[model samples]
Target: MNGDWLLRGRDGRLTVYLKSDDAVLCRAELAPGGPWEPFRRIGGDLGLQQGPAAVGQGDDGYAHLVSWRQAGTGESRLVHSTHFRPLLAPLDWSPVGHPNGRGDRTGTPAVAVDDRRRAYVFVRNAGGGVSLLVQKERGGWYPWRDLKGSSIQDQLAAASRESGLVEVYAATPERILHWRQEEPGRTPTRDETADVAARPGTLRALRTSAERTTLFFTDQGGELCAWRPGGKPVPLLQAAGPGPVAAVRCEIDGHDCTVLAQRSASGRVAFAAYPTEQEQAGAWWTESGPPLPPAAEIALAVDAHGTLVAATLDPTDATLRVTRRKAEAGLALEGWREV
Candidate 1:
């Protein structure tokens, strides 16, 4: 993973960044049928501490972002921004679950949002252990709950607004673990576990439909794997050579789903697909280019009618690339030259 792009969602619109090491609340938008907008500091200029950011929408339909700023004493402050404005003069978020506590020493803390607009943060706890904490919808942190395993190479969690269930995917010593809120107001339950040849990290999930949920993860081998509930997991095409596989969901065409995976080191990318229940069941993937240059990052958004809008790093010149596909074309991409 590049570790440069941070994911954020607000008012059903998602924004990400390719370069955030310098800008605060740095974000880029993929306009419909338009080129990617340049990186602009959306929220106001935050002083010294710039990174460890996350974005999401609230029940009130406003966009929100939370960033961890480093203090001079090496402590961290949690800054919350609502609708692109910082709130409460920057809360001192030194602790993993509170302001007085301390967190992981080396890694940047991560945050996520649930359907109810609540945010959860995953970080190393005060006990020198990695764990997750629930930030209630009303804006208070909960107790730090230890994750199942010790080393969380990467942790990702999302809440489905449609199902009202929170899903958390983590990498542990044993395998790739998936946890979902079993019922409303109840703690999440481990729904499934899959053995990973590579300590699976870099996971992404898409609940395209109420009955369909898909997950993408990069194993220890740096290869990509797509897990579909009740179906055999599909292996994504890895760029030839040694590197991490970056994959993002593009769109859903009827029974066919599309995803774009980029090989970082080689800058090669492949547009892959999997058949739904109405279609055949098997691990079938197709590629586009001859493993050309790599892009900075990839972003995918599907419209209500199932139309796909893919925003990715252009291989030829390293600019932004966008592609749209309707259901009738069979997703057989053509003329994907750099624009």
Candidate 2:
């Protein structure tokens, strides 16, 4: 499971969408930090192979999700749904719709919402090129528009800002490709980032501020790496483990920080913090704390009050566990509590 499957909604609620036995299950916290509701079957029976990619709090304050479902005939389709009242009882979801047309060989879909509250879904089309579908504020989805780029070698990541710009990134075999659109209904500009061999399906992106964005991925040598828009690729750790990497932009000790978490090669989950202006220095990854139980998947996020929380699925027992670190603790194992 990809840790990016968990998202913090606009209302400050955490919602997770995962795949289990041909079904897509959704579980969300009643509030930010605890007492998660029972898992609910949102979409299923279409052969969901990958977990859903979601974005919360679009213009309508609802969560938008996209996933790729395979049929018995071996045909794949991109499906989408939205939660009407994600934070309240009687939660409702829109009907599942195939946005990429039936029988399209699309990679796992990624979603992001721009400043206008319009939701954009990115996927690799049957031709191996990137394509996008847009959903407007009034609850209508536009037709698929091809972004027209080189063949995508991995899943895509997307980030948006209040200025109505949506940026999408994908890794080719040799380098990462970036596409930027300043507003909805506008053509996007394309560019290439650092020249490094990126592992498939490991690319992730986060918008740290109005003027800064960060990209994280594992390189061909299994080392965790990061790259900014115009900076060179920097290796953060040597030979990190094989799991999804997650990052969140938050405040730590009254300073802006980007917390990165991933499983180490020894099966322990560890995290490090990179303060502002130190991300590209290549020597700033804080000391990793004690290991947790071997995790099949991990998710990381920051609460409304600047608390760092982590959730991991224990591979041994197949149980989900959560831990949190307060700001004053500075990412130490002693400050982490299993909640």
lDDT of 2 at 156: 84
What tens-digit string does per-residue lDDT give for candidate 2 at 211-305? 55677888999888877777788787764567668788777777788777777766667677777547555433343445656546777776545
Top candidate by lDDT: 2
Q: Could you estimate the TM-score for every candidate?
A: 0.70, 0.84
Q: After superposition, how far is residue 298 of candidate 2 from its true place, in Å?
A: 1.4
Mind giving the per-residue lDDT tens digits that candidate 1 earns over 186-298?
A: 56666777776444336565555564556666666555667765565566644333433333344444444545444444454445565532223433334444444533455
Winning model by TM-score:
2
